[model samples]
Target: MSKVFLSAKLPAATTKILTDHGLTVSVYAGEGLISHAELLKSVVDVDYLITPLSTQVDAAVIDAAPKLKLIANFGAGFNNIDAAYAKTKGIQVTNTPAVSTNSVAEVTVGLMLALSHRIVEGDAQMRTSGFPGWAPLYFLGSEIAGKTLGIVGFGNIGREVARKARALAVNVQYWQPHRLTDPEERSLGVQYVEFADLVQTSDFISINAPQKPDNHHQFSAAVFKEMKATAFLINVGRGPIVDEAALLTALQQGVIGGAALDVYEHEPQVTAGLEKLNNVILTPHIGNATVEARAAMGTIVANNVVLLEQGHNAKFIVNA
Candidate 1:
């Protein structure tokens, strides 16, 4: 029988899918995340390993699992797995990419609105100091309508962001390594622009790109300096894409009017002073935390594992 190991416990229904296919499934039932030592010990006899996006399945882990045939990742992003090494070892890697796109896109737009309108700040004031009543120019905030929104890394989430932002009368422009065709651009109601122009001209900026070695810290001090002083930045991408220290400085000095981030350069350990800043809105990386998204991701994970066991090519293979 093909034995499968889960680094963390998933929905029972998901595990049942594997069992129905005649595969043995093992789940890590610990409260917190599984440690590196625990992971190394668990995968010894498993044919398939399912892990969270944050768990690191490095070359060392790969070498330890001689029977491992597949790494079925539970998240859209698969950066945690050493896919290239897995490929060399004749192992397949798969990610659930499509499941979380809408959930993340919705959070991206929600962050934009919260940041521009100071929603969090107002709520805090109403709870603590109490509202001083409405008056002209009292607790002023900007409207997203008629504003230029520049999107960095135009992929699934970025395109979705453009579609939603356009509904609010916001002009959307995007920049990526490959520019979309003219028809594609017009149909989406978005324009393709050079990266430099996008940063300088946009009233709001959203970073929706994946994390890559070449693109790490892409938004540094220099890029922040080029942005409009009244502009806002929204990052739902990987944490390391933006330099948190540099971002902290920018927020402190008003380099770019304000910012909202769902992910940080050092996740769970945000740079000092960011939490104290009222100009920035910070979230605990819940971009894909919706109940619907998680359920879909679980289904994809089970489906991929079942496919591989059935001698069929799995869907959403990252390391083909």
Candidate 2:
């Protein structure tokens, strides 16, 4: 039986599958995130490593695990893992993609609605008894109907968001490196525009792009300035894609209306300035945290490890 190091606690279903397969699963059993030193100690002499996006499985950590054959990530984003280095060591890397797409897309849309309608502000006012009386023009907000929704990256999750927005009667536009054909665009009810045009024309921008070298700091002060003053931004994708400092300035200077972020640039340690803004809706990177989504992701991770150990192809191999 192969030895598996479960860096983060997984669902009971995942644990059963690994144990049923006769793999010796060693869990950290810690209350919070496992530290680098702890992870190094846990992964030593382990045949497989199952971890989350928060875990940093870098070269140093990998070097400590001489027996590691596979690194199974709990989510779609493997930005936390060093894929190139893992490949060099003849170690397979896998991510659980497609499992949490709809759940995350739904959260992105929910954030957009909350920001557009000022739901958080209304709740705060009601809680503090600030709503003395209702007026005809009280708590004015923009409607989602007939508004242009520009998606930065049109991947599976982005496409799912578009479909949901269309059901709400929204005009969808997308910008990616590769342009879709006219027929494909018609089917998705989206048009591919240049990055600058998407920023300038979109009434609401939802970022669903991956975090890559070219996309780092993609939304800077210049990009924010290009947007319409009434436009809102929503990010359900990776953090560092948007410059937090630039986003703060945009909200402060009224360059853009507001933003709803599920992920942040620094993550877990959001900038102090952003916390002061009531116009922004922030979540601690819980986009794909639904019970169903987490279970599905965990199952995928477990199956990937099993497949790799059995010398079969995993469902979503990052190195491939």
Which structure among the candidates has the greatest TM-score? Answer: 2
Candidate 2, superposed: residue stretches over 4 Å from native = none
For model 1 the TM-score comes to 0.97
- Decoy 2 TM-score against native: 0.98
Clashing pairs in model 1, backbone N/Cα/C closer than 3 A: none
lDDT by residue for model 2 over 1-320, one digit each (tens)? 79998888889999999999999998989888999999988888899999999999999999999999999999899999999999999988999989889998899889878988999988988898688787989899888999999999999999999999999999999999999889989998888899999999999999998899999999999999899999999988888999999999999999999999889888867877887898998888888999999999989989988898788988888986
Task: Tell me the tens digit of each residue's lDDT in model 1 across 1-320.
Answer: 99999999887778989999999888998878898888999999899999998789999899999999999999888899999999999999999997788999999999889988999999989999999888998998989999999999889999999999999999999999999999999999999999999999999999999999988999999999999999999999888989889988998999988989888886667889999999889898899998888889999989989998888999999988
lDDT of the candidates, in the order given = 0.91, 0.91
- Segments of candidate 1 deviating more than 4 angstroms: none
RMSD of 1: 1.2
Q: Judge candidate 2 against the unseen true structure and give its global Cα lDDT, from 0 to 1.
A: 0.91
